[model samples]
Each structure stands twice: as C-alpha cells, then as structure tokens.
Target: MKVGTKEAAELLRICTQRVRQLLKEGRIKGAEKGDRFWEIPLFDGKPEVKEGRRGPKPNWKKRVSKAISRICVNQHLIRSNSKHGTNKPVIRVESRGIIRYFHSLEINGSCKVVYRPDKPLSCGAKLWLEVASDVMLTAFVYS
Candidate 1:
C-alpha cells in the first residue's frame, strides 16, 4: 500500500518537510501526486535524503558578543563575556509546533548584590535587545 509523505518520511527515517523537498525535486521513486496529497511507495530500505544546507551553522568557539539592551530605562551597549560566571544570558528553545524564544539572566557559582544610587543591578525592568536577525549575540542580562 502507498503511504502519505509524512508516513514515507517516518519509514525513511527523515523529516516530513524533507520528504516534501525530495518530492519537489523528483528524487523519490514510485511517488505519485494524489488529489489531496502525494502517494509515496514504501520500500524495504530507507530512502536517500538530499544533501544541502538544512539550516544555519553558528560558530561556538567565539564567546564574546555585544548587544544593545534597555537597562533602567536607558539603552546601553552590553558586551557579554562568557568568562564571567555571573550575569550571563541563557536562551531556551521551546518544543512545540512553532519555535519559541525564551531568555533569562543566569548566575552561576557565586552572586553578589550591590546597591548604588546612580545605577541599580535589577534595572527595574525586563531585558530587551536590539539587533539584526543575522547577528548573533549572547547578552548578559542583569535582573
């Protein structure tokens, strides 16, 4: 029996989206277009997935990143240093139908709170960044 693209992807040990790409490129054998979907013929072995740039690759060796964030109602260019244990930004990707961006300030090992009249540590607000989509930055958020 023929299967849909999603089922074919499962049998092939690949993603459904990639299966669709393969279908578009005419790479899948015994693949036919149905009224509602593409009917793919399932075989005994795994199908060959296309080789291309699936996504962006980030450089992990570099750690120092710069970001413009609003702290205490003022915008300052924040330079994040991974060497520092405290005040490092942590990004979390939520597992769901759509990818979610969640950011928080983290302090590891030791933390010290200093009170100053001119500048505060908490900043009395959440961190907001201003940067381009192509740029990558690890912001040091102060909470």
Candidate 2:
C-alpha cells in the first residue's frame, strides 16, 4: 500500500522534515506521487532505521575519548599551581559496563579527571576535585 508523507511521519513517530530527510538520505523507500506529495510503500518486514551506520560501532575507548573532548570544550581547566588557590573540579561520568573507568589528564593549568562508576551512576551525580581558579574542567568517563 502507498502512504503520504504525513502518514509516514505518523507511523515512524518522527517529524515530517525527518521523514523527508530519510527520503533524501535513501534510508527509506518512497516516491514522489504528485506535486508536493510523496508516497511510501508499506512493507511487511521491520523498518530498517539507520543510525551511525556509516562507521563501525563506537568502541568504549573511543566513546570515552569523545566524551572527554566534549568536556574540555565545555569547561575551563584550572591548573594545580594557581596562586589564587584551587576550586573543586567537576567530574561527569557515563558508563556502558559494570566496571568503573577513569580517564585523567591535565588541561590548561588544572587536572581534568573523569571517573565511570562500576555500576551505572544515577542520572545526575555531583562529584568534586581540585583545580585552579581560572581553569575549570569537566571530565566524563564511560565504560
């Protein structure tokens, strides 16, 4: 059976723009039926949704690296030897495994550290560390 873009969007639980995007990306099969109208075919098989399929599944190490990069970009890092004194650095942790993981490095003049809990931590947890006055860092460690 053929369905319009609105029907397709409703069935897919996504915005119509997303439906059009999928069509443009060639992830879903559809055809232009008329002026400003498109038809999507109904299939018995499961809908094949593509998410990050162009590359390999991100490894844990790679995820941690990317998370750390994000944190560095978001926060300032205070170094160990700032004359004004140090502030507690903020640690953001995310995990995909049972064992805890730690990714540590010094950025700017501060020590930026990430710690993943052995078990998944609560969605929001506040942790502390020491850093310079001008530099603050956020660290995220994921399993």
Q: Compared with the true structure, what per-residue lDDT tens digits does model 2 show for residues 4-71? A: 77756654556789778777777775455567777677553113344546666423212212112223
What are the RMSDs of all candidates, in order? 16.8, 16.7
lDDT of 1 by residue, 1-143 (tens): 46788756655556789789879988777788978799876443333333445554322212322212221222221234334544433442211122222244332222223335554334333433333221223434445
Task: Please list the residue runs of candidate 2 whose C-alpha ends up more than 4 Å from where it truly belongs after superposition.
Answer: 45-143
Top model number, TM-score: 1
Backbone clash total, candidate 2: 11
**Which lDDT value does model 1 have at 45?**
31
Query: What is the C-alpha local distance difference test score of candidate 1?
Result: 0.45
Give the alpha-carbon lDDT of every model.
0.45, 0.45
On the 0 to 100 scale, the lDDT of residue 30 in model 1 is 76
TM-scores of all predicted structures: 0.32, 0.31
